[model samples]
Target: MDTPSYRERLNRVLRYIENHLDDSPDLEALSAVACFSPYHFHRIFSAMVGESVAAYVRRLRLERAAMQLSLSDVTITQVALAAGYDSLDAFSRAFRAQFKVLPSAYRRNDGPLEQARRYSIGQPLFYHLAPDVPPIDVQIRSFAPMWVATLRYTGPYDDCYPAWETLMAAMQTQGLLTVDTFACAVSHDNPDITPVDKCRMEVCLSLPPGMTANTLAVRNLLQDKRIYLRVIGSNSDYAVIEVNGPYSLLHPAYRSLYWQWLPQSGREPDDDPGFEVYYNSPQSTEPQDLRTGIFIPLLMG
Candidate 1:
């Protein structure tokens, strides 16, 4: 099947899920939305989206609940019930597991990043959050569609650096690395929602135009290494911010963008996962000197 066709079907499924979050749509109904068979839908959904259907729905529900808690005056029980939990105790347990705070506490706190700091005490990376974080500078930028070769790692975000090394080495051996190559990291799971041990990160390098997964050279290289080639489509409007410190700062930067800027900016984030473009190698550059660009896609009118 053509890649675009597959993507189109899955995108439809995503929209369907978002609009019907409270319904708790069954697998058969979701599969029909994507025009896929019930037996194969779960596997395809997980493979294409990087998470199972149930997990995706649950995360979206909790995320919505979080927005309501932070942005509105909704009661704890009401928020819990809206998130699909039958009991307040069950919702509180789930919320605390995801956000590290009970619904009431999260509502009272300044933001999720602030709450995360309490649990991360004594960690150097988290120390930056102690001081009041300055307002992040965001630029609206457009990006071109590009192809990237990626290596997927399933583990703690801190431990995924080796995956980048392995991917870069493999690409270099194939003579794919060049002066114009771009390196990026795609985070598939939110640390607050997914367990740290189960987080997924895809270390990626942009391939030169005309290089793709179907290329004979790339196909042969993938025979041994667990690498994937996919296209990142263009977006005319992306809320881009530059981070110029240790990687730990990225979490707060994102929090500021979503929790602080987004509501006031009059822009809505698209469903696509945001990605980070690294400008320098952490191995060579000092943590304070490293630079990264965070790109969050915006929904089109």
Candidate 2:
């Protein structure tokens, strides 16, 4: 499975430092909570938590200071010193920066809720989604490499089939492709910023071995990191219809295989090719249509 979000780790680290405030803490000590090396601790903490580790420590101390100021008869000077400030003036300066209120005002009516609320802000692959798609067996095999006359375009995925057809038409005269040929779409753009118009999809054919780039009349298929998954059963079957036709819209599919079958199958996606090859065949004589099996590259232990 992929790593969990950095934010989750940051939250845990924050909880640890906040809870251990009574003990005088050091950077090396706090970094242990995050599992980062001591050398880069400050940078990682700052990047994930949006503040220096020291600043986070300072704010938390003030947050507790605000609480202590309200609940007890402790004077402002004592609360400041207890919260790790050397003097009342220093504590006051830091407190007003974060809470927009001085120690004096906050002690009168301390609010922890408002400060913590700020941290709560907001912050796809093919074969990976199998298993809920039960009976799916996407294997990573050494695909005998082939050459393809290729076409590249960036558009909505629904718009891909047409672009593929254009490539087919352009290469048909050259006999580069034929009926029941395997068609592959290489994903080129990152999911972020490629949601619609910016998303890049490529239609390609495997080229013969020893062929140079110029041999492809159009352009050669660009090798890319991808996932391949095999879709089983005939297209009309409910399970086979997992990939929606153009009319429907859904997510890129959940990575249920990683969640379940991986431990069961003891397999993982291949790292180098980074693709799943789906295997399928035409069970009927339909123009430009046939069965498809998704093949994703995998590394099985």
Candidate 3:
């Protein structure tokens, strides 16, 4: 199948899976969603996505269950049922197999509840925030609502190039990208907590105002009044350093900011999801010379 057509069909099925996680979608139903024959869909999905459809669904369920455990005060039994497990024992076994951490322990120690409350309060305060180090620059800027054309990719970060290529081609065909065009990647899951195979990422290009997308998967990102305590430094905000390197090195930079910088900075993360704005294209720029700016949305004290 062609790239755009394949991405459209596969993205549709993936979105369907996300929207209906509690409901088990059989191979025939998934194949119908992908518009491929049942046998053909199974082989093609595994080959292209690097995991079988059943495995993919189960992983998503378990990972989401983990997220709920860490982020919410929901009971283990309720979480298990929401994850489509019949019993807490089965969910516990599956969670342990995947994460090697028990559900209860995960909730008490490393969950969002623990991280935010503990890190901000007593003992864990000394862990990463270093006031001796220079402050990180963060800009609080407002932006007009952006109309974007997007393609969702549901696999490893490295596997996202195909989706970008597909989206770019569609943009070029529709005459969307121009001198003022902005490009960004929207990350939907935290890699530390979510499995790489199940991570959701989108390659997006800003579209002209009032432009209508021909594809079903296109979405609008409205940020009219959205406020961000951005980590990309300026004279008024905190200090930010530019890192020109492979994308894999980004995690360390994030660690430095959150652990090494955030505590001393007196800022907390906002609800808005952080994203990367690409200043240079990977297709033309070498990995070593790539220029990408990482922005973490935050709340200033």
Best by TM-score: 1
The 10-residue segment with the lowest total lDDT in model 2: 232-241
User: What are the RMSDs of all candidates, in order?
Assistant: 6.9, 18.6, 8.4
lDDT of 1 by residue, 1-301 (tens): 3264665577668757866889976999999998999999888999988789998888778877876776556788998899999999999898887778788877776446445445445643223443544557899998787888877676899898888888888888887888889999878666665568767677889886688787776776565336667666475689999988888888778766776567668888886777889999899999988999999999874
Best-to-worst lDDT order: 1, 3, 2
Pairs that collide in candidate 1 are none
Considering summed lDDT, which 10 consecutive residues are worst modelled in model 3? 222-231
The deviation in Å at residue 137 for candidate 3 is 10
TM-score of each: 0.68, 0.37, 0.63
**Clash totals for all candidate models:** 0, 39, 6
The regions of model 2 sitting more than 4 angstroms off are 1-135, 138-140, 188-194, 208-254, 272-290
Residue 85 displacement in candidate 2 (angstroms):
30
| lDDT (tens digit, per residue) of candidate 3 on 1-301 | 4464665677677767766777886889999998999979988888767788888888888877876786556898999898888888998898888888788988887665456456646444223334323333444553334656666666687779987777666666556557777787767676767777768886777776555544322322211111111122222222334456567655545555555455566676554446677888877889888866766666655
Measured with C-alpha atoms, the lDDT of residue 203 in candidate 3 is: 71
Model 1, backbone clash pairs (residues 3+ apart or across chains), number = 0
Of models 2 and 3, which has the larger TM-score? 3
Global CA lDDT of candidate 3, please? 0.65
